[model samples]
Target: MVQLSNNSALIFDGLALESYVSGKRSFMRTPSVSLLLPSPEGTRRAFLIMRNVTAINPLCLPAKAWQQNVAAAVRPAQLPGVQSHSGCHNQTGTCVDDSNAPVWQRCWKQVCQNIDVACSGARLNSAGNPAPTYYDINLLDVALFCPVVLDQACLDSLGPLGCTLLYESGAGPGMLPAAPLAVALGDATGSQGGGHGSATPLVVGVIVGGVVLLVVAVGVVVLLVRRRRPQAQTAKTGGAPFHEGLDSLGTRSTTSAAGTVGLSMLPTESTARAFPTMGSAGSGATGSGHAAPSTWPLPDANKRAHSQGSDTTVITNQTPIGDCEFDVKIEMPPQDGVAGACVGGSAQPDVQLTGIVLGRGAFGRVYQGIYNGQAVAVKLLTELTVDSADQACEAMMQELEVLGRCNHPNVVKVLAASSLDAARPALVLELMETSLDKVLYAKPGHLLSLQLVLHIALETAKGLAYLHPTVLHRDLKPANVLLRDPGSDKPVVKLSDFGLSRIRHSVLKTMHPEAGTPAYMAPECFDLTAGGLTHRTDCYSFGVLLWEMLAGAQPWYGMTAVQIAYEVTLLSRRLPLRPKNTPGGQVLERWPHRLSALLSGCFERDPQRRPAAADIVKALALAQQDLDNLSRRATPTRTAVE
Candidate 1:
């Protein structure tokens, strides 16, 4: 006989059971019966009545009979409590001497009861003291101890109710089940009535209702988890930022700094993320260690384009439009003495100035502005020095000329120009999030994967390729490479800042003073008399940029611009390659031999030996293919982090 609160008693007869309340008549006698009694804390406790007990003492009951009774009463499949072990509990009502049972089963009774009762005199310790027994067990411990029983298939088959109960009672592989179980437990404990005279049937009904509600809630959670599994797996395996709606073809829409809209189709985010890191950002070609890739923005549809020479190839699904009124204005004579000139209308007065400076350079200051309610970057020429007014004007016009003629996707565009007041000339250009130089320096530890580096190399080369035969970006460095933040898509890189750029034909005859960053200047650039500056000059700067991307350190550290110029011009010194065992070299070690050879070719001292921009694109494509193949052959690894 067991006594419950509210003066209730469960009496076991030899063949039947009776539930009686003090000061009230006996309710009923039945072969098998159960009662759900409400506690002061508003939690329900389940009590089972054992009928036809041959032995009055609970401990004297046969082990097999006890197991059968407990199993039938608890019904773990339906209630998610203990599976019933005769050895788990003895006559004293203490959970003890359950060494033969699995650890999970030994602790299941306490887990289901949500209690922390201590066992006394269960076993002896080496110190001759009573060894304490804890009924609490963690879910991770259960999964680790009994992986086969709690495998994915078994967990799924448990259904929401059983699974929630088991999970709440400490079962599963991760902490994911803890939250839902907590909610279920809290709700179950909060829904009970405090009245003492409530009917047994009403109390049971409430408990059942709470269980059903908890099951539904857990089922909903299970569905949501199943839905996010694919995305979570992709993020874990890919190791790159996830993007939504990215399709197999890797196509996306982008807008340029010039407001020119275009479409770009590149590799998917997973493919890009899997690319290995080649070097640290901003590290010079000779740096000893490599830095992880930072978040480099990929070009969007408006800023990316594919073209073969003069023919625009629409690889992505987009419509092409004719030239707009905002065409760039070229003051200089056309290349090869061509008669046609590209001109654009004056800037609209409606353009609003925000006065927020985005960046500053020797030539001018770039400010974040708004035009037609769209964000833009406005480059204003610096105030002329006492004797440099004419020179500054000429530089501004040269920039306008080069930018105006450029319609390629990778090149920055000029939206409009205002020279009506020559003293305050300004160029309204498309705004970019930041420059490659800033990206490298800002995120020193974020190593870029090889695939993304190759992509940048290819895009930069494409811009240069388009500029060749018509224009030359005399100053090509990481600083000039502008990036657009695509939010969810990969970042887009565009070549900007053409203050020193020159038309190809004019460069062949002109022997002007040095006009670009000395560190990026090719050997020929130091002595214009050796051979006129050509498109190849840009190649040399590109090679240096490549080295910077791989080395992730400053070029010629501890040397000034003058020293760098002298070293390349007089000493005939070039950027050094990484030795085999260095940290930076380790990054390069993963590269395919073809890629290494390509880098070597790009850095060749002989201008003629260096590959053209188009050739560089082809080489990068091949390297990217190698990376894709490697990713395909790789097996997925399980990660604990999201």
Candidate 2:
């Protein structure tokens, strides 16, 4: 694992090895990383090199490699603008095409052509300019090459002379040194100049070179005699000596932390198989530890285990459903109050998750996921759920069944869904930033304004109105309602969580195995003896929802489920019509009394007396108009000069 200064890293997990002197192929590809390096002087200053004993695999590394610190430099082969020709210095007067190119060209072109070789960088300097990032797939131990996976495709591109690179011989074979005066000699001789006309200049250079060499030799002898000490021995790492950070040598580190990547590399002659989302299967042959990416947010019960590097919510103590046994079919929703006939409809496919949990609920947990390049929220069953794993699957499937048939603005749109996981079925939905409950309780005493409250109420009612004819949202509450742009004045409301919702085909809908939050459950829900729940059951919940929005608190705050059930069912009581003892509570009082009166109707103990979703929408609309008209008259407008 070589971590680039700019967070770009080149990692090798698993591969076989070959010796450097006889190495022909390179397994590691430079384009796999994105690196940006500063070029203050500009013009191709440095490029990357991956010289290693083995294919960057931890399993292949010996114990000594990890024992002590070894420093290796990621130095470039050529000097700045030296213009050195190819290494193929043919004694026979035969010309080859690639023989005339620069020193690093073979390593550069050999890197995959499909990949964009030039880096579109992100790291910048004081002037806000990005550094130049270059890659040369020449990461072979110059002195000790390793056997790689690729047979011949990854071989060095340059011909026979290409085997010897600049790192071994400074100016490349048959080329003049890049030193100060030596550079002028090469330039005068020219790339193809073989005429005797350059004899006089060559003769003058030899005399000057001899004199300069004598003076430098004498100076070195005096310094060595005075010091009388031997040169310090480095750890003698495989590559050049290097350090950390963005310096003259660049960000590439030669040696890094060791880890294994299981390539399923077989001793038999065969190619390895890997996917985009490959799990880390290190070679246990070396006892190297590894872990899978923990993108999934686990439940509260599993939080402690997760903190200690354990896996996220895994289904246990439950039966798993393999091939989904449930059959799915849906009807096209009614348009213009005319219901469409039943038709063959298919359920959505299962989605892959990154294991990141976003939110959790009674029955299901939500995880952040991506589908077809779009971010989505995938709902899966929690470790500890509403009832059993079976019920959780039932609820997820039920929600999918309902959402598949409906397409309304206020309703949450389902992108994909599948209950094949059985114990942990998935429901992928369009990602919403926040939920109404999250925003409402973001801070204590953070009350919603009259306009904002009505906006939510109106949208929620419209969604209910759309669903009432065919289905009923049995569990309606703040958490179930999603908000798109919560920061804006008019945030869009999307009614979600249809697990408790059921198709209203029967006049008396019997909610068997009765399950719902007792605080929001209608009074009729408590008594199974009374006529089973109706569309108006949602009306009771809507009434509580309004009170919650107005007061910025729970309807029966600090009360247990049993206490709430006793108070609502046995006592037949509803929340106060006005938001009492709350900040911005007076905003509701200032509004027209019609909204309050509508709330009273929604809370009617008798299901028949409660307003239907359609009627509630009409009443909220009227109340909105009255409030707006009152605002116009109350405002003191600029008087015209008479």
Candidate 3:
């Protein structure tokens, strides 16, 4: 049995010594622990790797005390009963002895049991259960025994054990020499204890002393490295000046209720009505029955004409008599000059801009508007100039073309568009209550239930699947996903913001410059020369989005976008699959194995290995069913309590 110290700083098993170390003074500053176990060859020599250590202690000891205690433990004289096992030889005939076999077995058994308890606790806590102790185990191969299922079983069974048999590479007992100080100390302790010597107790103390020295050395090296390493500045979430062009990178900004645009704030009815009505030539005709062309000169501000006897508003321009009104004609036509155009000479429905700012993007500002009495969102090109107007117009046209093809319910619908001038064009679209990013960051109290997350995931996959053959949503972050009826009990998610979308064929043919929010960007996006954007790129972003929803925290929150891009693409580091000690961690614990596997598949670095949207949809559906059943079972228990 392994026993925890009163403060939980040290753990004691009869076979080995394990102690927690505080990393507050070291770089990375992550708390770590050290465990020393006898080598499989029945020797006191052991190997230690000082990377990726997990904190196992709950006490959280101070660095000073940890160092002091650790230092004291490494002294040879301080160790008790450490002696060389007799009859255990490094001879040609035999290295193993009968008397020493049982001692090694007991020692190995205790070490395995302690490891099992730690790993099992970690796994249980990861699944959302409140385990008494928290343990962070490094499953990396640097450790003598990786905690794989088969190895764990072997450890439990005390089966054939050796570095050669257990691991592919690492120091084995045969390769290392026994510590002379430890062996001498063990001999001294054995002589002092009435000359009744035993190898097991002596070996345990010697091993403990060696581990102590190694840990101290590693700690000092880690401290020096940390002091020399430059600290990366983290982006502040509060009270910092907003960086220019940072808004374009999908960063959320402060907005107010007064920002909402209502119908009363729009241009006067007559002025709004003067814009050309395509397919109907006389649609702008006044009450006097004089037909006016859609393209007409602007009226002088001082010239107000009164209507005669009929409350009919007449807008007359103050132009000299015989002056042609249609001096600057502007052609307004639907895309391809056909689809979505007024059919059978029907009058175009009037749309009024509410002047409310829904949100601002890199090139446009979305507003609340009323289209033919139905609420809609209006995306108006902003900061346009003679030089950039053509570029903006092209982008608007591209989005229109893409949105025109996508008719899925999961995708935002484009209602209408008018490009009276390339400099000032507008697109009316289906209005949504809020964006997923706003729901996640703005409202902390109202956390999304697991069911809602699954629903959103399913819908997002469906939308992507529908767009796969033709369109690629180059930027697929949570900010672009809008939630409809967000205040309602059952909110629905829809994909929006197609400005960065590209036609799949076009993306493949040309090595276009990378464009996207870096946090959600895939590894391939960092290098366009490797291969142009593929449908799998969207899948990678989706995996990050899913992780954000589950964790309820931005991925790599402290790191800058560039830093994240570099680390993720070049260094190949990924965010932890499960959050530590957060509400999101609780949710992740309840995640089904298949759901976890699906997420893993989506995040595969190899684009070709990633599963298609269809597969993701199917997997989410199964996960949703499992969640539903769990909810049903919990409902009865809640009712009984109430």
Candidate 4:
């Protein structure tokens, strides 16, 4: 230690500041000396030792020796019920260090307040569990330091004799340094949240910044999307200009003209701006007049003129724009006596084929097709006994009722239907190629990756979630599932074929004659005595479907339909698989344990035990997140490969 001749001291080594410094900071060395604060009783005083003195000239002292010297110099305070000690000893009473207690308590309270603020601010604990924040060391640093400073300031404000200016001062209000300036300083500088009124500006700034970014991104995207949309429409049109005169004539045309028929004509610019293609009708013209002469190489001038001449006769008979009464031409099938039907021949064009048969049963055959040139699958009801046909028609009507009300990506879409011929009713649907059965069994060598399986489960649950608890898919099976090429980062798996679906308004009354795939049939189906067509039946079917996805095949097999039903009913045989691998073991051996447990829950023997599809979706999504975390580090197991 160096003592200047001027009675000043210098210390640099191992010095823990007992109080906040008052002025511009400077280091000095001091001979181990005890400092005192006068007590309430003038004769008594609080004493503490300063240690490990180092002079400005680089003098040093062993920390322990310095501590000993400081201890020797300190005098115990003579306060009632208080025991004071030198430098480092544990001391008790008002005379000892309660200096930091209030500060720490205040800091702790703020920590809890901050947590509450975060919870409320982020909207966590809402309808669903909040997505977790990524662990951030930077935020932690801020959290840790903010309180430490507050605690120091809290101590300083409560106690006197410390340098208040250096201790309490901050760059801004409410950001006062509670602790040492060194501890308080960080790379970050900003007010976190202000008073209620002040908070608005910061929030506004953040929102404005976000909105600015969003607007910029949206603008760029709109520009690109605008450019691309027109290009796409033009390309799809085969470079035809349907809107050339649309702006001036206030007429509109669309690519749909190519869908139902070939070339459709429009009146010129003074009359109608855009042309209608084949079969579609417009307000000004009758749709049925001369069909385009050829499918390919759309009509040349001579051919068009010839067709126009023929159309003039038909147009003359049709109503003009202003006429209250007009004979509008309507497209109708050419008049012919109904073709004689062979016993097994398709009744009219109710059923069409694409050679890709998805499923066939006693009820009907479902084949993928190109309806109106857009891909669709057509289901033709097979001839059945009068009673079975009636039952099947009833089922189809119920399905149509349910599907019509539902508009979700995961649920199958019902398009056009032909009920005109009760003998051969048909339904047209958007085509989806991959069926759960095809995914499970058709491709023998492929393994059901954990990711794809979870996705299917999630999507199925989503579909079920859309339906009220009263409605149920009585016939949930692999065959009922259809996959679409969603053209996305994570393309979706869609559920299709609502044919055995039922919507019961309530427990009061529901259709009977229990039916569904045998292997997927829930045990409740066997309980004909009790009505089993509730949502629980769907749950049971879901369980079986989950089992199939996990197992990569149907749960039960090798029996006639009757025998399978008997076994399912009498044996109470659940899917014969577990999460582990053995001969005929659980589905994918590599699936996550949590996912396996979730799948088991779906297939539970008791209907009441099963989680709702919404909960299931939540669980699967969580599992998917876990899988995604693992996926980011490596190629995801759930790539939607063709």
Candidate 5:
């Protein structure tokens, strides 16, 4: 216990502050404590303790249990063994301890404000359940240790507190002590999501900080670092906290708290949500065209992902892509060999194969692998789809030629290609987490909002526009559109699987009549006799995708592929638009008339009359603008909080 004078303070044995002093900023893994402001009864407070405190996996917690735990975490309680702060002047009413130090009080107030917003958002789901969430601890860490670790500017960001904590008292830069820091740099030791094998999985829990900070110590910026005896860890299940920084301070450690921290939390595969994580934000997609992923301030899913409020029907798969309402997609046959060089001059050797197959197809398989230090998708050709080795080699060459030329952020990229004579002919490609179809059908609470729909549409259209006038993605259905959320709730869409695409083709009768998915194909696809295939063929498919997204269901929920071809091509029928929402998951009140009109243009009977991909991109951009205006009008401007 410390003094309760004009600047009353609580003290810990001094935890992780030592590591920051030792220059292990990147490895500061510690349990984070965030105070939730209680109802304004003169500085009452409660805090949520994170970093593997609960025994059961938070993902598996029942709705009731989850709520109880959260209630417990946020319940107001006095600091243990400490009385009211007579010196505490909490005019703002966010402080918990009595500290006259401006920096100390100011830091807690700012933290309380942010926690106020996040706790409200993360506390409940649409069904009013307590959804598990990972609140960022970095924000708090920066405030408390700014002077001790961060530069002058970093310390300055916290306003007057900066000078008061660092220079004003001449106590010098200081902070509370923490657990020993530790670091283990290596690849994730292969634990696929949702695996329930008997083998004990050494799951690396997200290490916000592998520490328990208890006190709001006051004095000099830092009390001289006291080496507290190692605290025993509470029981944990399935996974253990990953320790960050080097374990230079202690010999006592948990079985698994021996590795990295300061990383993003891994989602349990049981939830079926594979959004982009700061760590391994999807294997491919790491080319120069894409920006490095960053950590985002994620709010509650219910705040952004609203219920679809669309048709809830069961769709049974007929063929690969169901159309008798068969909505399942079937793989298209590979084309004959291309004459150009598949490997050109920059041929890459076999990828560092993890042997983890991501997907399998008729001509080959996609593997989760690493290439030159980056996670990548390795698409390899095999003899299963072809009669001979030569045929397999030719198929790989053809697929590579089509994708190798594409270099755009919105298109799946080809990083490297193998030679036709290599031991394993493969294509090293950027990997995204899930297909657009998955995003559209994401759990009711994580479905698409209009802003996201338009975003996916604009990005997809841009990819198409880049390919047009030269290539035709004969199949442009939702299944071909890949998505990666990259920390932001909005998923980034990129076109993939150009297996059915044709490049630099002529009106000369094509070789494969059944080249595209029947549901997404243009009428001319049914009868090349009707008209020649062009980029317009892809527009029709894109329009169908837009309908699927709005409807939040398959385009032809109950129709067969043969029937779809007949109805769409001959009768000129289209599925109705599904309902859509805004960023906050509320019904987009501005409703997209422009989007309806664009769909009409795309579905024009005459290919010549259909809007081009570039035209579609422009129209989608307008819808985005409409969303911005609607948001501004709906939300009242307020002075900034804290």
Candidate 6:
């Protein structure tokens, strides 16, 4: 992982070996990621690479080769002003003939085209200077035969490379060193020079070549010394000598070329055929290691031995709804003269909150209160709710059904809900200081305290685990999670908001309606028949929220909610937010990607492929635990503190 600046970061996971040396096809098309810029500077541009391998999945060979193709395609353009010649015409009046040109030429054409599009009607800041635009060029480990240049042609056009912009050489053949220099284009607007005659262009080329040579020289020396080191022995044995990050070398083995692998060796059936059934199948596989199909309600009580084995690795066997039965009823409460207004005595003043307004919504306002002398949050449904009584009642019912039986420390407890009155069906909830969105984005710093973020993720997962049985908190964005304090060393996150939540019983499981905040909705939600929405939907939302929390803002950018949703579903639109000056960006530049991959398992268009909420909890818990261990090891022990 690598941190570019205070605002951006990056994480890289392993790509197949062929992406570096072979011309293979890539598996990930339009790889979307969330990115952040420290200051809205002029066009932030970056290059990302993924490399490293511990084991070889022969089936993934094609994907590896494709990754290399993408990397190779993007590298040559790094030469700054060394534009690739192609039949490309941009607003700059530059023409590129990409048909007969090399990959670099094509890359250059694309970059130029992007610049033209980005700068269109771009506004200037108060200082009358164009705000910095941002661009991220992804080169997924295509092996480079020569060093690439970063010069004025590229830098001046794009401004500072925001967040993490790296050149990685791993897998395939190792990357050759490149001289990173700045090219001085004297008055770039000047008239074109004579064909191959201008001294200015020639001098710039000479400078670039000189820098390349220097880098190569140093690289050669480094390689030679590395070859002689004891670590070389391990490297030759297909073992990595360095850790994976922007600076580390990631390598995988592949003796057979990509195409040589027989298709027969791969599964001939469609991915759908290989998929397991939804809820029932999930419970069967999880409750017992034997892997059978489960019935409705997840019958694990009689299968002790199997449950124990599966419980260690699989989570479907554990259902939060096991012992409790939900009491369902339909009754309309009375409403005062005010539309949706419901009044009640202040009997719980001891536990009612005072003057502070904890939250607000389109319907009404929520205030802090005290209940039993403890802090509480009271939400007063407004007259508007009474006006739309039917829809409001249904929404409230859904919330109660889902949240009433939920049990998790991270989830806000619904002490009580009064739907007796259409005008005042107020809800009582445990009080917390603020929402995750407020802590991470509303305030000035805009950065989540690292430890606090980790804790929040953990606690939220715990709550999710409990919701997996009969309900799934479909809306799991930062705004739905409450924070305990502004100054607490460790922030406590409590999951809230169950209006869009759903309850999925084994016997009553059905698809969920497409509804949620655009930025947080999972791809699977688009399909109304997606029965797996029970737990997997939450996972997808979690991924988006995680990215936003790390980036300190919204996960996707668009002018409106509709645009954001469309981009997310079709294009997987994402911005790169890693910082350019920090190692965090280098090491974790692709962390968001890993999260996306996991979310895919949960957010599968098909529910069967989606892992249960319990699985999600386990995976996230493990990740958090790993981080904790790493932190403990990194921190020096102080006698007084200890």
Write the residue-wise lDDT of candidate 3 on 435-541 in tens digits.
99998887663457777788888888888876663366878988999998876646787899887665432123222436778888888777633323457888888
| Model 1 / residue 136 / CA error / Å | 99
TM-score of every model versus the real structure: 0.45, 0.44, 0.45, 0.42, 0.43, 0.43
Q: What is the lDDT of residue 622 in candidate 3?
A: 88
Q: Tens-digit lDDT track for model 4 on 1-642?
A: 001111111111222222111121211112111111111222111111122311111111122322332222212212112112232222123321111122222111112101100010011123321221111000001111011122333323332112222223321112211111211101112211111100000000011111223353344334333323322354532322222112232321121211110111122121111111111112111222222221112112122221211111111101111101111111112225543332223333433355566678678777675545477766667656877987777656655545544556777766655551346556666678667676566556455666677777787877776653534667777777777653333556667767665433222122242466777776757654332244656767787787666655556656776777677667766665463432224434445677667767766655556777667778888988888887786763466442
Q: What tens-digit string does per-residue lDDT give for candidate 1 at 87-116? A: 323223443222222223322211211111
lDDT of 5: 0.42
Q: Point out where model 5 deviates above 4 Å.
A: 1-349, 383-395, 422-424, 444-446, 486-490, 505-509, 578-591, 639-642
Error of 3 at 132 (Å): 82
Candidate 3 is scored at a TM of 0.45
> Superposing all C-alpha atoms, what RMSD in Å does each candidate have to the true structure?
33.7, 30.3, 34.5, 36.7, 28.5, 26.1
Which regions of candidate 4 deviate over 4 angstroms? 1-359, 367-373, 385-387, 420-422, 486-489, 508-513, 559-573, 577-591, 632-642
Rank candidates, TM-score, best first: 1, 3, 2, 5, 6, 4
Off by over 4 Å in 1: 1-348, 486-489, 579-583, 636-642
* C-alpha local distance difference test of each model: 0.44, 0.45, 0.44, 0.39, 0.42, 0.39
- lDDT (C-alpha) at residue 129 in model 2: 25
How big is the positional error of residue 360 in model 4, measured in Å on the Cα after superposition?
2.8
User: Candidate 6, TM-score vs. the true structure?
Assistant: 0.43
Comparison by TM-score, 2 against 4, better one: 2
Q: Show where candidate 2 strays beyond 4 Å.
A: 1-355, 382-387, 419-423, 511-514, 584-591, 640-642
Question: What is the per-residue lDDT of model 2 for residues 1-642, given as tens digits with 9 covering 90 to 100?
Answer: 111221122322212222111111111211122212222232221233333222211011111221110111122333112212122111234322221122222111111111111211122234522222332223333221111111121112221112122212222222111111101112111221100110111111001111223353344334323321111122221112211223233322222122111101112222221111111122221112332121222123212221110111111101111212132222233458775332223444334455567797766568787666677787766564455767676666667656655556788877655434443456668898898999889998888777788888998998887776346688898989999899887888899988876543223224341467777888868764332456788898898888788778777888997788788767877777665665545554533578778889988876667898878889988877887887888887778322
Error of 4 at 80 (Å): 97
In model 5, the worst 10-residue window by lDDT is: 317-326
- Once fitted onto the true fold, the runs of candidate 6 whose alpha carbons sit more than 4 angstroms away are 1-355, 385-387, 442-445, 507-512, 528-532, 572-611, 632-642
